[model samples]
Target: MKEKIKIGMIGLGGRGMGLLRLVILNMSDVEVVALCDRYEDRQTKAADKVEEKQGSRPFVTIDYQEVLSIDEIDAVIISTSWADHIDIAIASMEAGKYVATEVGGAYSVQECWRLVEAYERTKIPCMILENCCYGRDELMVLNMVKQGLFGEIVHCAGGYQHDLRDEIAYGYENRHYRLDNYINRNCENYPTHEIGPIARILDINRGNRMVSLVSMASKAKGMKEYIKNEKSHDSELAKLDFMQGDIVTTIIKCAHGETITITLDTTLPRYYSRGFTVRGTKGMYTEENQSVYIDGSHDHYQSWNKNWGNAEEFREKYEHPIWSKFLEEGVQGGHGGADWLVLADFFESVKKGTQTPLDVYDMASWMCISTLSEDSIAMGGHPIAIPDFTNGKWITRQ
Candidate 1:
């Protein structure tokens, strides 16, 4: 029988709570041991839910270090703010705990470097929980690419675009930091979700890494408008430091001659879209308008629907037998229930003492865009270099 992986959770905020709920509901092979939150109120509230789910009260604390003090913990689920992810991740890694960080992983380049160093130094796993990688449509696209069905996928475009100012002005309790995260950084600052899964399908950093990125932005329209019409007092608006109406665009180059475009906009109207397009040597597969195009012999192309990224049908026709053996793993969830899928992978990897499919190197590759884009934006759209966290060893190590 496989050993149960004891989990310690840090930051019981909204997203953290959602993931906690997911683990309680979906992951049967794990045990929730510790829960931490800086806000006492949130800690108390979430503890009740945690007790209800686990049928036993967890070791709860307002101090994160207290959660880390649990020597019995085998791993930790970090759902802290973007700014805090790196610090907690490194600390947990140093503490001999497998660390799974919330999306976007780290905020700064230095923090990313630290995360890689911690993994290399400790040999314990560090993962960026880019749940989108497990999403059904995303995974189906990846499976097709791997089968050489889509041929040599060349170019891809994706993003995490949304209107977040409302969440800032009047969204939810405990949303101040999250709302601030949106307006402070360029829109595409968080691009891992839309890119991670597709890139995996195409085997990007697995073979080649992004070399450079050039980021540019437009005016900040939404911020300016909101401030202009805020309230009768308007004092709060004047005090805020904002450059509204900006649309950040980042163009990336992969060493394998593939290119990707990422766009970010929060000072505008909102709609979130994730793209799946594989322009291969013989044909094209797209998640756009819900269709796939296969090259034809005589100017007439074969179009496919329900074949491109149909998670249900793809699951039925999946060529990978391993995905089937783990069928009961990710029962019901989003990203084709990828959150559960990847977590399942983590558990299995831990049990077998094997390398995680998305390893430390994958974490670095996955996080490069946001880090570089920030620099590119800081330099007024100057090109920035991506540090090969693999230390000159380009592709897979060990």
Candidate 2:
């Protein structure tokens, strides 16, 4: 029998609690041995869930360092707020534990470098828990690209297009972190969700690297307008100033002759989507419409008939091996079963002592987008070079 990989969980907010619940439900190979959060209430809640699911309460504490100090924990899942990710991940790695951290862009390029250096110094595996890489549709597109359907990729466009006015404006209700971030930061704060999959498809930090990027932001009017119209005209948020733009668009150029456009549209009023769009010499795929178009696959005039081929058909044919296995057995948790897979991969990598699929270099490169974009935006959309956290090794780092 495979040995159980003892685990510690930090930060018991919604995202953290959601992942802890996923591990309890789906990951029998993992043992939730420790639970930590800054709040006693969250710690109690997580401890209760662990006991209810596993029939035993974990070692609970309000301090994350206590969880890290435990000797039995083989790995830790850091689901802290955006500003705290790098610090927690580096600490976990330095404590001789593998780490799986939640998705969010880094606050500064220096912090990203610190994360990279921590992994380098410790030789500990660290994965950014980019659950979107396990999304069924996203994986199917990746498989098709691997199979040469989207030949010689030219460009891709994606975004966090969710309408998050209420969530950001009401951050105080649940002690959520977005309110202050939106009020102060002027970058794509949550970029890893869309960029993670795109980076894999683009083979960033493997064969290609992001060369430079430019960013622009619309005026910060959405939250104030939303508060006045939705909450109250005289609400305190309506009188406060916000730095985040209603929509921030960034364009990235890759070393291997590819360009990516990332649009951050969360603060606005729009239907939720990642807007996964891939264009190549031979074909194109768009997640918003759930359709794909290949050159010469359809009649030239038929393309104008609004009946593009459905993505479901492609999913049936080319579901990723991971999703295929889950479909045959079962799938659980949020993000269309992605959360469970992300945790499963983390646990499995820990058990096997193998390099995580979303390794440290990918973590640094993907997370640094926010800081780099911030610089670009502040410089009036001037280009900013993305650091190669792989240390000149991406050219041969397969």
Candidate 3:
């Protein structure tokens, strides 16, 4: 493996552009040698950023085939639309390049299986770039679970709670994909943002798997209400009926008897948060209040005594090694610097020819929640069984 990894980036949307900037500025071991996007302006802008940092412009093309044909490109980052994620990942692996894909749930169970089969056949790493797994607080919570501080994890809760009314309403002008998804989908459209961190703490696809799940969605009134009240009353979207619900909650049952709950709370009026919550036999933690409680521990008793535990102290003591290192070396970029850490880890793993933190099974398990939830919701919250993407290999994956 070379010390420097050559890469190509596809789709220059907000998420993709943000990641591209992080790679250019923070990932010293990565060189983005090719840029591909349907939009010429986005591709040119990304190339300018690369050239500004590396003193040389990379190959730019509107066609992704040109990117895959580059002999120097060792990996490709697929940040395209949600529908294109699986197809691009499969193609990248078939072309003998490692793949890193943006966060989105799978549209179909067959697509998830296709990704698993492609990775198994090609033996190339395909990572679903879920940045929340590397979040500072999330990693600390995971370390706490690993260290048995949270004895016998029982349940975990997370959600993508944000207000995206304007973003989705005007998406047609910007070619954003969420508008169409929100207009047509009736299930959990985005699950990775919340489920990724919870899956890591639970060791999903290692010794445990999400056996089944059920989902329920409220009526889709937020977008229409926003279009009528916020936008012009005569706007087209005001009369348009959206299939997605304002709040979609999914309850997942793990094979080990633990349960997890994930919520999709976008398209409504709310503050921004993933709302990561972890509960166990011994203690619990909630991200919304930045609080933690442990049974019989000083923090637990102290909270009873003084109305709150010293969350700052707990964080200082239990910060993950990755965040500790990032803090020492200057934290920068998206999601309070988790983006930089995840991208750097990806490059380092590729350079060393090692498995990524988020492997194909993990990706399949996390992503399949979307389609399964759709099935469950359509059946009026009937429990839908999650497919075992590993096909019994999960028993020994650890």
Candidate 3 clash figure, as a count: 0
Per TM-score, the best of the predicted structures is: 2
TM-score of each: 0.87, 0.97, 0.96
Off by over 4 Å in 1: 171-173, 226-235, 238-245, 297-330, 334-336, 396-398
Q: How well is each residue in 295-364 modelled by candidate 1, as lDDT tens digits? A: 6522344344435444344456743544565464435554455666677777677666666677777776
Point out the worst 10-residue segment of candidate 1 by lDDT. 297-306
lDDT assessment of candidate 2? 0.88
> How well does candidate 3 score on lDDT at residue 287?
84
State the lDDT of candidate 2 residue by residue for 1-398, as single tens digits.
24888889898899888877765445677789998899999999889988998888899988899999999899998888989999999999999999999988888999999999999999999999998999988899999999999899999989999998889888988799999999999998888888989998999988999989999999998998888888785467778989999899999999998999998998887899999999999988998788888788855565443755477778777888888999998878887898888878878888889999999999998889999999988989999999889889999988
Mark the regions of model 2 whose C-alpha exceeds 4 Å error after superposition: 303-305
Q: How accurate is candidate 3 locally (lDDT)?
A: 0.87
Order of the predicted models by TM-score, top scorer first: 2, 3, 1
lDDT scores in order: 0.69, 0.88, 0.87
